[model samples]
Target: MTVVEADGSFVEPFVTKNLYINSGETYSVLVKADQNSSRNYWITTNAIKAHHDFVQAPPPISDRVIVLLNTQNLINGYPHWSGNNRSLSLPHTPYLIALKYNVTEAFDQNPPPDTNDIESYDIYDVSENKNAISSNSIYRIGFNTTVDFILQNANTVKPNHSETHTWHMHGQEFWILGYGSGKFDKVHDTKSYNLINPIMRNTVPLYPYGWTALRFRADNPGVWLFHCHIEFHFYMGMGIVFEAGLEKVGTLPTSIMGCGKTKDMIRP
Candidate 1:
């Protein structure tokens, strides 16, 4: 069977019953159904290091977000992975990345601190803010631009409890730069980024209360979905979209044109 890397690259074919799939990661494997002809085989999945109960000291203010002054110095000339704000609410609406046809806009190359710089707080701290998660939240990038995203897992609502998330992206495969425990230290972590021969994959796993970094160029012209691979988490709103190169996206096919308010635009 062949395994797909985070950057959409193919790995040498191999075989294994035990597969590790992260929250947002997707895999395409080939299986030969050459088992016993009389009996059916059972397929199953289990989570390793699924539970955590270790309490960690709060992160220092300075460590909440680690900004990269020279993104160009990085392997792909993209921003580094900064941490995320530990919030449960749906951060924004779906389809926020859908761009109007023929619209051209320049997005800032500088890494934004919205997700990276925000500190994780106890869920109780902001429980009263009904709209803590903004519906208008969106991240836009220029076409063919390389981007680096750092996914950080923090303690869940339960004390001493952290969970694993499979981060997956649509439309493009990214290189798994690196993974580390605790908060992401730019200086220390950047030293370990795999610039050469890194596995290309669409989905990567993040250790509990740890961090994983990835990089990819947004060459595909469309609004792509990037989100946690876990179904329950996705249902609970753990995903976002990347709108890239809208001006280059010429037109929508009639098959995808009719829906909601656009029903009138459907072709016969």
Candidate 2:
């Protein structure tokens, strides 16, 4: 049996029996949703619970590129790094958040929304990394180097925990830029954020309940993973892909036209 909201977004409703809640008992409940199906469900002691507020969908993962963000346990004391039943081999980034993406439309102009976006977290850098990309080709870090992303808060009942959210990347280091806490704006664009001096690093922090911008070069080519560092948040589905150093393949003269980048690493 499952509990569901009146609107039917989640699987289960808010009744006492529907939500496996023990009054006065402070216990952590593991909330879950279906990764493949539209029916969102959570696991409980008595049965597999469902709710209407939550949506069951697969988190976003871009095969063309790889993105990894550490959301859930950013602090040094989290179990992902210190406890016996450790969750991660590497230290979680400064912040973590849940996210989702469509396999087909992930790179499209408009994307779907999840509960985590109601308030976004982000960070940016402007300093360029000299060794960010190793390549034989000559590409300057002038206009060719820039990175930015946006987050949408579609949830009405945003989580009431920390007001700050941080985001970080993996593999190639990037420069910090600027960030905001609203929808995409054209006038206040972050395309040329810190066009002056740029910092370099693989990880950047995104603020809670807001959006962030960044700039980097597509110098490295390979499959790099980008997702929320928070194991729980990552499991919740906040991730993306970045494909740099991709080599473009030519098509035959017959008509089987095709174009793609080489999946090889390029360092300057």
Candidate 1 deviant stretches above 4 angstroms: 1-98, 101-114, 118-131, 134-136, 264-268
TM-score of 2: 0.36
Candidate 2 residue-wise lDDT, 140-235, digit = tens? 112223444443221111233223333455656555555555443435654435555555555655554354555555455433455456555444
In model 2, what lDDT does residue 123 have? 22
- Lowest summed lDDT window (length 10), candidate 2: 93-102
**Top candidate by lDDT:** 1
Best candidate per TM-score, number?
A: 1
> Per-prediction TM-score, please?
0.57, 0.36
Per-residue lDDT over 210-261 for candidate 1, one digit per residue giving the tens place of the 0 to 100 score? 7787777778987786777888665454555557877886656655644433
lDDT of each: 0.54, 0.34
The superposed Cα distance between candidate 2 and the true structure at residue 164, in angstroms, equals 4.3
